[model samples]
Target: MITHTTQSVSKANIFLTCTDEKYYRDELIVEKNTVIRMISGEMKIILPDITYVIGAGDTIFFPRNDLAKVWKTGKDGRPYKSVAIYLTPEAMQQYAIKHHIKPIHPSPRTGIKCMAAHPLLDSLFNSLVPYFNLKNELPESLAEAKVDEAISILKLIDQEVFNTISNVEEPGKINLAEFMEKNFMFNMPMDKFGYLTGRSLTTFKRDFKKAFYTSPQKWLTQKRLALAHYQITEKKRRPVDVYLEVGFENLSHFSYAFKKQYGYAPSSI
Candidate 1:
C-alpha cells in the first residue's frame, strides 16, 4: 500500500512530511494557520474553483479551518518531501499582544495563498532541515520562537495573513446550497459541514432538506457518484482513480455504489 508519514522536527508543531508514492491524495481540515514549503517533487491543492500546483521551492499558506484536497507526487525518482510549520492560536495571540496589534475586520474568503519568492521565508524553511536529523525534539521555547518569527515574516509580506491572524470572528451562516455544492467532495462529517457553514447539526439537516429536497447524506452520495460517473466515462479515468477524488471512502463501496447507480460495473466503462 502507498503510505505517507509525518515526523515532528520540533515538538511545537514543525513537521517534515515524506512520501515515496508516485501519487497520494487526501482531504484535510486545517486546524491552524499552516505554512508549507515544498522541499522536493510537487503538490497540488484543490479548492472549490481553483487548483494550485506547486513544485519544489514553492511555499503555500493555508488558513485555519479551511478544507482542502491535496495530491502529493514524487517526481524524477525522488520522493515527495515538504516541511510544514503550524502557527497555533496561542502563539498568534501572544505575538499580537506583544506587538500591540489589534484585531482587524475579517477579510473575504480566499483559498490557499501562495507566497512570492522571498529570502526570509525561504531561509526560515531551509533552516529547519537540520532539525530533522536531531534525535531529540527541539525545545518548546525555541520552537515557539520559530513560529513567532514566521508570524512576523508573514505580517511583513502578506497583509492577508496578518488580517487572518488578527480577525477573531467565527464562521457565520452562509448559503447552504452554495456551500454544500462547492464542498460536497470533501467527505467530512455532517457536524463538521454544519460547523464550517456556521450552523448547528440540527439546522444543517433541516436546511439541507429544504435546499436539496433530500437528506444531506443522500445528496452528498448522489453528487459524488454523479461526478465519479462523469470522470470515469468522459474523462477516461478508472474506478480506483475516480473513487477517492469523488469522495468515496474505498474501492469496494465505490464499485458497489457505481454498479447500483448505473446497473453496470464501473470497470466496464
Candidate 2:
C-alpha cells in the first residue's frame, strides 16, 4: 500500500499514485475536492455507506475531508495508477470570484460520486500521465495550472458534479447504525469514526450500543475475525495479508482472537 501525499511536492495538491495492491487502507483526505482519475488497474473506495469500483479511465469526485477506506489492486501484476487533485481553499475561492459562481452551501447528494466520462476530462488526465515518472516534483506553476485545467472541465461535465466540486463540503449528519455497518472494516480509533460521523465521542458510543446491543470493540473483533476466517479458508489469502486488511494490528493478536472465535488457528484451516 502506498501512503503518499502530493502535498510534499506542491501545495497545489497534485499527487501521483502507483500501486500493485492495497489492503483495506484508511486515509484522511485533506481537501474535499474533485478530479480523481484512474489511469490503470482497479481501485475501490469504500465510503461509510457507498462503494465504487474505479477501473482504468474512471473519474470520481469526492467530498472534502472524506475519511475513506480503500482497496487497490493491479491487473496482471501491473501497478494501479491514478492522480488526485484536491480543491484547495484558495483555488475554490479564486474560482468563485472569476466565474462569478456564488459560494453556495448546497450539500452533495451522494457520499462519493462519479462523473460521466467526457473526452475533455479524458484528454486532461492523459496529459498528466508523464508526470508520475519525473525525477523531481512538477514545477509549482505547472502543477497548479494542471489542477486549474481539471476544474475547468468539471463546469461542462455535469451540473451536479460542478456543484459538488464547487461547494464547501460539510460532514454528513447520518444514521449512526448505517454508518458503522459500512465502515467497520477500518482499523481506526473510535474517536476518528465518531468525528467523521459528526458526533461527539461519548454520544457515538452510547448510540452504538443502542443500535448494536453490543460494545463497539467487541463487535469489531468478532466482525474482523469472521472475515479473516472467510478469507483464509475460502479466498485462500495468507494469514499475514488478512490480518491488517481486516483491521487487526498484528498477527499474534489476530491469531488469539481468531482461535477464540472459531476454535481453530488461522493456519489450521
Candidate 3:
C-alpha cells in the first residue's frame, strides 16, 4: 500500500512522503506548480511526453497546469521509499505573471542526460528539505518568500541549462534499438519512452545510430519480435496475444514488421 499526506494552505497544496510500501511499484501524482526534490534514493518521473530519472540531491520543478507521475524503485533491492512536495497552479500563475516570467512547460523528452547542475539551485533545494519535512507553523509570508526564492533559482538554472536545448530544432529520427531491448516490455507511449531517457525523437535517433549504427523504429521492431519469439517458445503465450501485448495495434502490421526484422513471420515462431 502507498502512504501519504495531503495538505492545503491558503495559496498552495502539498503532498509529502507519498509512496507504495511494497517497493515494487511506487508512484506520486503531481499537479501543476509542484517542486519535488529527491531527499534520498532514486526516483523516475514518467510523463505522457517524457521521463526523467532523479537521483538523490536533485530537485525538479513543475510549472502550473502540468500533470506528472513519479516512480521509485525499491531499497535493499526490495521496495522504494520517497517524499514529495506539491504546489498549486494558482499560486504559481500569480507569481509568474506578476513577475513577468514565462511559465515553465513540460519537457518534450526524458532523462538528465542534457541537464547540468547549478551550484546555487542545488544549494537552495538542499536547504528546503527540513522545512518540507517539518510542515509546521511557518509564517505565510516566509513560506511564500521561500517558494519564490526557489522559483527564482530555478529560473536562473533554466536560463542557463535548458534554454538552448529547448530552442534547438529536434533531429528527424531516433534510434532506440538498445533502449528497446532493455525496456520495451513496459507499455508506455513513444513520447514517454523518449522522454524518460531525455532525448527528443530527432536527437534520440541521431545519438542512437551514432552509438549503435541502427534506427530506433527498426530496433524496436526487432526487440518486439525477439520478445514474441521468447514468449512463444518459453512462456507459452500465443503469437497473437504477444503481438497485442507488446503494443502492436494490428496483427497484420505486427506480422509484416516481424518478418521484415527477423526474416520470419511471427507465426513461424
Candidate 4:
C-alpha cells in the first residue's frame, strides 16, 4: 500500500501530496498556484466531451474555478506523486501588481489548459521535497520568491499561457449547466452548489428549474440514482461499493433512496 502523505510548504501556502487512491471531487475554484507535476503513475480527468489521461512528467496548469472530474490511481511502489502550489485570488493579484504584469481577461471566460514542458519543473519540485520533508517553517517573503521563480519558468515556456491562467477570477464564474454536468456525482448541499456556480440561493434554484425543468434536489437525485442503477446493473457493482460512489453518504439512506427511486433494493438490481 502507498502511504499517503501531504506536506505543506507554509511560506508559499502550497500543499504537496502523494496518494494511491480514487475519489469524486466537488467543483472548486483553484485557490492556489495550482500546478500538478505528475512524478509517476497515471491519472484521468473526465470532462464533458473528453477524457484526458496524464502520465509521468506532464505538467498541467488548472486555472481557478475550472471544474474537474478527476480520478487518480497508482500501483504499489510507483504511487501518484504530485506538487501543488496553492494561491489565493489576493496573492495572484498582488503578484501581478508587483511584477508590473497585465493579465488579459477573456470576454466569455477562459478554460483550463495543459501548460506542458516546463524544463525546470522537475528540478524545482526536487528542491522543494527537502523542505517538505524537514517540516521547517520559513519566512513568507522567501515563499513569495519561490512562487515568482515558478512563474518565471512558466513564463519562459509560454508567457501568454502563464499570464492568462495566473490571473484569477471570481468563484461561480462557470456556466451553471456545464458546471453541474461535470460535477453531479459529488453529493454536496444545494447551497454549496449555488455558491460554486456563482448564484444566490434563490437565483440558483430559479435557474436550475429553468435549465433542467425540475427542482435542483429532484434533478440531482435523479442523476445520482440513474448512475447508481447503471453501475449496479451494467458494471456488476455491489450495493456496498455503489452507494458511496454515487454520492449517498450512508448505506441506509442510500438503500432507502435507491428503493424509492427504482422500486427495488439496490442489491436486487
For this target, which candidate reaches the highest lDDT against the unseen true structure? 1
Q: How accurate is candidate 4 locally (lDDT)?
A: 0.69
Clashes of each: 0, 1, 19, 7
lDDT (C-alpha, whole model) for all candidates: 0.85, 0.74, 0.54, 0.69
Runs of candidate 4 with Cα error greater than 4 angstroms are 1-9, 18-29, 40-56, 69-74, 78-80, 107-115, 171-175, 234-245
RMSD to the hidden true structure, all candidates: 1.9, 4.4, 10.3, 3.7
Two-way TM-score contest, 1 vs 4, winner: 1
lDDT of candidate 1 over 1-269, digit per residue (tens): 46655433445689888888767877998877789999998898988778899999999989888989898888888888999998777777788898898766677744689989999998899888888887887888888888889999988988777778665567799998998888899988899999988999999999999998989988899999999999988999888877887898899999998899899999998
Which regions of candidate 3 fall more than 4 Å away from where they truly are?
Answer: 1-15, 18-30, 46-51, 61-70, 76-87, 97-115, 132-135, 160-269
lDDT of 2 by residue, 1-269 (tens): 45432122233477667655443244544345656888777877765557778888889877665656667777655567777887666787777787787786776444477778889988887787777668787788887788777777877777776676666655656698877776677778787778778788898898889989999999988888877888899999999877876778789999998988888899887
Model 1 misplaced regions, further than 4 Å: 4-10
Ordered by lDDT, highest first, the candidates read 1, 2, 4, 3
Model 4: lDDT of residue 192: 71
What TM-score, over all chains together, does every model reach?
0.92, 0.73, 0.45, 0.77
Candidate 3 residue-wise lDDT, 45-150, digit = tens: 6553467887765666554323344456544443343333344444556666779867455445333332356787567555654555454665667667766665
Winner on TM-score (2 vs 4): 4
Segments of candidate 2 deviating more than 4 angstroms:
1-11, 19-31, 44-55, 65-68, 73-78, 130-142, 209-214, 226-245
Error of 1 at 17 (Å): 1.6
Model 4, residue 268: distance off in Å is 2.3
How far residue 189's Cα lies from its native spot in candidate 2, in Å, is 2.1
N/CA/C clash count, model 2: 1
Name the top TM-score candidate: 1
Per-residue lDDT value at 216 in model 2 = 92
